[model samples]
Target chain A: EAEVAQSPRYKITEKSQAVAFWCDPISGHATLYWYRQILGQGPELLVQFQDESVVDDSQLPKDRFSAERLKGVDSTLKIQPAELGDSAMYLCASSSRLSYNEQFFGPGTRLTVL
Target chain B: SQQGEEDPQALSIQEGENATMNCSYKTSINNLQWYRQNSGRGLVHLILIRSNEREKHSGRLRVTLDTSKKSSSLLITASRAADTASYFCATVSDRGSTLGRLYFGRGTQLTVWP
Candidate 1:
């Protein structure tokens, strides 16, 4: 079965450094999302893309965080000058073009900032 | 803002018993879905129930949705130790726009002891 793929299963970096995570959604999926999960808390949306165009990024910290899906199939999320609070699990998910369709998620990248 | 909330933040059950988790949401939704996540792994879609449907079943899992109450419940019968994980509920709004955006709840953590 096809599954969403992500890289850098674990990342450790110091504060003020830069870090990036990559995600490749299942083939033919039209919607992609990025979420962050703090320990003991539910995942929170960071950004969403629909076929290379950002549909919602209201919660993204624009000054230090950015995400892109140039070709609409794969995506990259970057954090410049990462902070201690940036230590969390980053998750990527994708879904087909159907209202209320189920989303498939990839194994997340756990980032630890020291 | 997150649209879904789940009750019983944590639960512990014995293997072979049944486990139930409840979730409530605050908006008109086209569908409600349940997902399972092992620690440090990605979420796995378990079931989805449409606004027009009241209940759905897949294997040992049964899900119920009440649109009028904006609530849903997931029941896992004959639970096993492998079922120990975090379960979340997500809601997709009926608004035609934002078609792929899903608001998730703070998941319920279930531990099935063998």
Candidate 2:
């Protein structure tokens, strides 16, 4: 029953504003991920972290988006100057390297950019 | 740039019936995983098949992976109305820096009627 945790389950902001989402993964999970799910579409990886170090962030829009896992446990994703298209569900996932590659996902933070 | 593409965008079935979904990937994968998401909620990991595994079973769910064909199938037998959700397939690549990065498909919307 160790579930990934997310905060501020819902967020609404105007375009050009700043928004941030937080996620706490399962205990001892070494890999953490941030994903964005547009309405009616699957989640897409925005950034991945392995023990506080970024592993893959090719799909991340570095100009306006940033993510971090400072302690290698909990992570934060921020969208600065949020655009209308940034409205989506932001999800966090984690999996331990010692376990099978099955990821546990958090309830997610739904962002609405008006 | 999704690595997996799930077949049949939507499926409707009666309770107790079997539900099967297929996913095709574009590259060699270290593993393929299936996840379910209820409306407005986070994803729940359903099953994962590694590159070396062909088939796996958990309760009423049976997952088959054809690594040669870069495809995987998830079959849920004796489904219930609660099984109504969006199901997605995610792929982890065999290449560098992609082991923990999951590329996901658009997902299939399943509506199981009671």
Candidate 3:
């Protein structure tokens, strides 16, 4: 079975540095999502995209975070001037449709900010 | 912020015993899903129950949903040490436009001792 792919399995950065995470959803999956999981907490949705268009980004910090899926195939999430609290596991997931469809998740990129 | 809330923040059981977890959400939803994650890893989708359905099963996993009560439950039978992980419940709201967006709950940690 095909799975979602993510890059930079682990990353360490200075508090003021920039960092980026990449994800490639399963082929033909039209819905992609970005989530942040704090230690011991549930994953929180950061953004959602549908066919290269952003559907929801209310929880994303626009001033410091930006995500794009230019061709709707692969996506990149960038954070400028990372904060200590920004350290967490960033997970990317994809689904074929909105309703009862199951989502496949990538082995997240663990970010550690010093 | 319309996320599901899981009960019994933590659970411990011996192998061969059954484990049960419950989840409650604040709003109407199109479907509810359950996922499992080992420490510091990505989520693995387990099962999904639609709002119009009452119960569904897959292998050793059983899920029950009550739309009127806005709650869901997951039962894992014949648990094993490998079943030790954090389980989360996520919901997709009825608002069709937010197709790819999922609101996840603070997961329940399950430890099945051998």
Q: Which candidate is the best by lDDT?
A: 3
> For residues B82-103, what per-residue lDDT tens digits would candidate 2 score against the true structure?
9999999999888774776778
What lDDT score is found at residue A40 in candidate 3? 86
Candidate 3 residues A63-90, lDDT tens each? 9999999998999999998999999999
Q: Rate the local accuracy (lDDT) of all candidates.
A: 0.91, 0.91, 0.93
Tell me the spans in candidate 3 whose CA falls farther than 4 Å from its real position. A98-100
Predicted candidate 3 versus true structure: per-residue lDDT over B1-114, tens digit per residue:
579999989999999999999999998898899999998889999998888999999999999999988999999999999999999999988876466467899999999999
Q: Of 1 and 3, which scores higher on DockQ?
A: 3
Tell me, per candidate, how large a share of the native contacts it keeps: 0.71, 0.87, 0.82
Ranking by DockQ: 2, 3, 1
Clashing pairs in 1: none
- Each prediction's TM-score versus the true structure: 0.95, 0.95, 0.96
| Interface root mean square deviation per prediction | 1.4, 1.3, 1.5
Across residues A1-114, which tens digit of lDDT does each residue of candidate 2 receive? Answer: 899999989999999999999999999999998999999889998999999999889899999999999999999999999999999999999999987378889999999999
Superior candidate under DockQ, 1 versus 2: 2
lDDT of 3: 0.93
- Model 1, CA-based lDDT: 0.91
C-alpha lDDT of residue B12 in model 3: 98
Worst 10 residues of 1 chain A by lDDT: A95-104
Best by DockQ: 2
Error of 2 at B104 (Å): 0.7
